[model samples]
Target: MLADYIHFMKDDFWFIVPALWFIGYACKRTPFIPDWLIVWILLCIGVLASCFFYGWSVRAIADGVIATGIAVFSHQIVKQTSARDQIE
Candidate 1:
């Protein structure tokens, strides 16, 4: 399962990953919805979008989740690091 995901990432999903990430990041700025809902909603959208390319399979959802996770994790890391730097 892991190998398959890695292969998919290397093949085509790499491009979509950043796009999904940015979508999640941008969602944080919206005022219409609660902050916590943004990521979850975007994640569902990402998975559904992936289905257009990879079909309704576990791999599609998994790839979507992995991409989302990467984006969210990177965002948090940057936020935390910047906050720490400002404090120091």
Candidate 2:
């Protein structure tokens, strides 16, 4: 099952995930960009970055989507976990 998802990632392309995380952080700190728009911005940037690194292909696009999803989901998980602790 895990092997099926391997194509969604490439060793060199894994850098995109952390890069997106930092970019998302910068976007979060920006006063001009609305919160809702950050995700869309990240998505667009992710796809473009993926294409730039992997070349324009359907798999590149897929990897971008997955990478972005991973980055955002990871941020949320950390954020929520920390917040939950604070509530205790």
Q: Over the full model, what C-alpha lDDT does candidate 2 score relative to the true structure?
A: 0.87
Per residue, candidate 2 scores C-alpha lDDT tens digits across 20-63 of: 99999999999999999999999999999999888999989988
Best by TM-score: 2
* TM-scores for all predictions: 0.75, 0.86
Best by lDDT: 2
- Cα RMSD to the true fold for all candidates: 3.8, 2.8
Worst 10 residues of 2 by lDDT: 1-10
**By how many angstroms RMSD does model 2 differ from the true structure?**
2.8
| Error in Å for residue 16 of model 1 | 2.1
